[model samples]
Target: MATPTRPGNYREQAKTYDLTRGASPTIVRAVAEHLGEPRGRTLLDIAGGTGNYAQVFATRGFRVTVVDAQLAMLEHSARKLGGGHAVAGAAAHLPFSDGSFDCATLVHAVHLLQDPSPALREAHRVLREGPLVAVDPTRENAPLFVHEYFGLHPPDDARPSAEDIALLLRRAGFATVEHHPFVYTDTADGSLHALHTNALHLAGPAYLRNTSFWYGLDEEARRAGLDALARDLRSGRLEERVRAHYLEAAVRGHETVFAAWP
Candidate 1:
């Protein structure tokens, strides 16, 4: 997914970013657990749109600062944080002094960076001997139904794998790097119908519009894919197809959290 270079690119999407792209509690728990006790330590959440993850960390007693390039996103983040720190800044050029934060998190936002190396180095610069935890969906995973339905296959050149992120951290002067692969399985009752319904819900318009995958597709492809999906949904074939897809791959996908010690 390409990162939007300007604030205007996210103006429209920022309004409903939280409604459609809320933080996954499971992922939030994993991030918190990895970071360990906050003990009133400060955390810098880079590219933290809407502060979804940052607010959760704040509740756990971490002094969280959410930084994003888009003012619109930071506006939502500011509201969610309730007078907490939310700054408009770029990842590579964070407006903070060295060793400012105790720990840092970059959840599902690394791919949005046009160039990740400088940002990773900057993260290393601002952190004071703490782990930088980054969470992202790796390329080495089962294809998501949303991607397949929308004809949104991420180009290998653009998508960074878990290994790539670890390598970047190491290059940025992190001493140790560990990868924890997380798979979010369906928790619904073990029924084909339920599974199909769950998959269908994920492919809905609200959810689709929020994903980077949907924006990656061309106008022609978007129209064609939507038409095909609509046809399937109307004809009752969507359930059957969704069931078959899940039967082939029971797990949702592989999202890895890379913890790098500075």
Candidate 2:
């Protein structure tokens, strides 16, 4: 199988993506409820993988436009969200006019962007007067137990800290950019924790199957990594603790809106 190099091609791995990395629907509902009514506003789900967020908006009676750079991702989103409208476009170059949407969001795909500012600007440009939300797991609050088990290190990408995200919103013409910490937690002995650990164990191999770019591991290092994670899981090292912090920004402009991009 050919390796998928772009985010759009993620559709080829969409099923696995959902199985391994899908967010809890309960959490989604909880978070969305905090943002208040979707009513009849139009929402632009930027870099919306598989249309998870877009569908959430739709279910709340909001008109949704799902945008992603990857065609495969858009296809998957369309399929999941009832063949709804989607745009094959980059976050930095949205094909909409100024003040086109009431809300904008980017979920978990910012680190992959070569330039996040332009995407931020595009999001601001497309919104009439609404909040731009970014929902991502913060480095400060990411699950630490899995880091050791998976050989995961700190992020190498340039990310705006939660504070920096609010500053960016202000710079992008949002009037009252505010942040709320959206946290996720599961205790050591909880079923949620077990499921997460098992999923993490499979995620790397699943990603490798789609693309074996694990630094040319020569099969030895690859096996070793998996073995290490497995050992940690069985010995209880993998269940130390789990928590994720999401940053939500309310951008000020034409109309009030709330969004979480992480």
In model 2, the worst 10-residue window by lDDT is: 245-254
Identify the leading candidate in terms of TM-score: 1
Q: Which digits, one per residue and each the tens of the lDDT, describe model 2 over residues 1-262?
A: 9854543336465545555445445345434654557878888889887677677678878788899887866787888676547888988899888888887777666655655678888888898756666665343332323334335464634334666666666676667765554333321111122234234443345544332124334466667777776665566654443211111111111011235332
- lDDT of prediction 1: 0.73
Instruction: Estimate TM-scores for all models.
Output: 0.84, 0.72
- Model 1 per-residue lDDT tens digits across residues 137-174: 66664444545566666565545677888899999989
Q: Who wins the lDDT comparison?
A: 1
Show model 2 residue runs off by greater than 4 Å. Answer: 1-12, 26-34, 142-145, 150-152, 155-159, 185-221, 241-262
